[model samples]
Target: MSNSQQQYPFYFKSTIILFGISLVCYALFVLSDILAPIAFSLVIAILLNPMVTKLQKRGVNKIVAISLAIGLAFLIVAGIIYFITNQIVNFGDNLPQLKLKFNENLANVQQWLNTHLNITIAKQQKLANEALNSSQALLGRTVGGALGILSLIFLIPIYVFLLLYYKTLIINFFHEVFAEENSAKVSEVLGATKAAIQSYMVGLLLEALVVAVLNSVALMIIGLDYAILIGVIGALLNMLPYIGGIIAIALPVILASVTKDGYSTQLAVVISYIVIQFVDNNFLVPFLVSSRVKINAFFSVLVVLLGGALWGISGMFLSIPFVAILKIIFDRLPEMKPWGKLLGDEVPTRHKGEIWQRKRLRQEASNPEKEKSL
Candidate 1:
């Protein structure tokens, strides 16, 4: 048998690989609740590592440094929640007036539909009733999602603390996994992974802050209520790759349409968000986040959609970092370098055949005598 066949029959190997991938995916889906917070905690721990190191360098105890780092992270998150909660309370107080206005608009729209398309109010009511029939299940889903978020809030901190406290042990265990001869390569991979993830987290935080500021300023100028709240929320949502950007734009536009008068304010809000996104994509991302992950847009979108399909919103948020980690590993292994290359945004090189053809063309161009002989 040829060497290729001796290694493994291509079809059999391909089937085994596919099966293994499927099994891994199913396991992830099954254990998502347990795994999600762990994944989140790992990212947070990595982010806080710099602060811990700085404190240790200053002669602070390791436990004290970790505690301080976690406390700081908690305060930042709590501040965001405080703003959001106050806005929500104010919004709740105005809900009755908003509902009254919404009913008036609905009546106007129903009348217009009747006049233009001869659709009766009765028919419209029936259609709405049909929609309301599914509201119970929708409400259940909403409650479940809220409960999941609550769990994350409670679980994530504990996980992060344990991970930070045991970080040295984890690093040593990782080193021990590889042969002593490969210690240098293992350490290199670990260092690169740490730097990439740390940079990624910092870049994302800076991007979100900038986006929130721009959004708040624009919305305030446009005379929108809760401008700060909406802007911050939108920025947080926009952290999710492909899907978040669309929702970020749509959300403010919807709120403006419902709460504000005329199309001008709505249009301005949309235009402002678009401009923010344009600048973010062209400038902020390239300068901050792009180098750290180096993932191609196509695969990023693909993983995001798959994540959403498999694990809902949490998956969407987690997918990119997981993919980046995988890419880091792939790049570190010689046999897996091609897979890493596939995930990257680097420009393609000419094939050997194309290179040979180009060389022949160049030679002919350089030598008229050789060309004539050919």
Candidate 2:
């Protein structure tokens, strides 16, 4: 019998792999509430690990060290929350005037439509009412989302504490799970994954802070209302990768359209945000977060959208880290190194099916170190 017929067929293996992936995606959506918090906690825990280790080396008890690290992280998060909510309170105080401005703008827009399109005033009023209702509904949803996020915040610290406390247990569990010869590989994967997640999260926070400052200054100079709040939000959203950047750009533009009188103000907002994004993409990301994870643009967008689809906002945030961990594991295994390369951004040789390129590919496949160097 031919090898294809005598052994498990490639199609059969492919089918199983496809099924496994679908099952995983479905499970992610189903168990998001349980998994998302844990995933987030793991990232925070990894970032805090070095501090905890330092304290441990200085003769602090593990629990004490972990607690101190978690406490510091909590304070940082709480400070950010306070900063945002303080702005939100100020925004609430201005609601009456903001609403008045919105109504005047809406009426002027309705009038313009009536004059330009020969639309009746009554029909325009109906459309305005519908829009107002939709806006209210959107506001309600936003409030709900905020509450959900606050709940997640409460759960995350507990998870981080537990993860940090059980750090050795987890390592021992891995050692027990993997075969004896693979112990070194397991440690390597763990160390690399921790470093990657830690760097990515810290770098992301630094990038966001810088971007927020720039955005706030630009918007303030443009004399936009609630400029600080909008700028901070845009910077935070920019952390979410592809889907987020669109939302970030759209939000400031929309705010400018409603509050600022002239089209020029809105145009300025657009131009400023575009320039800031240019700086962020070209300089800030490369300097800060890009090196650690290094997933290609295609997979970054794909996983982000998939994450949003499966686990909502938490999924979107967690996807890149999760992919990085996967790539680390894949790279550590000989059979899976190709899959790791698939997720990565590195493109050493571009042309397809060229003789030299094919030779390089074969060499890299045979020698994983060469592939990494390339």
Tens digit of lDDT per residue, candidate 2, span 176-246? Answer: 99899999988888888888988888889999999999999999999998889999999999999867778
Residue-level lDDT for 206 in candidate 2: 93
Cα lDDT of model 1 by residue, 237-335, tens digit: 888886788888887786777788889988999899989999999999888774465999999999987776556666777788888888989998999
lDDT for predicted candidate 1 compared with the true structure: 0.84
lDDT for residue 294 in candidate 1, whole number 0-100: 90
Using lDDT as the measure, the top candidate is 2
| lDDT score at residue 232, model 2, on the 0-100 scale | 96
Worst 10 residues of 1 by lDDT: 135-144
**Candidate 1 has which clashing residue pairs, if any?**
none
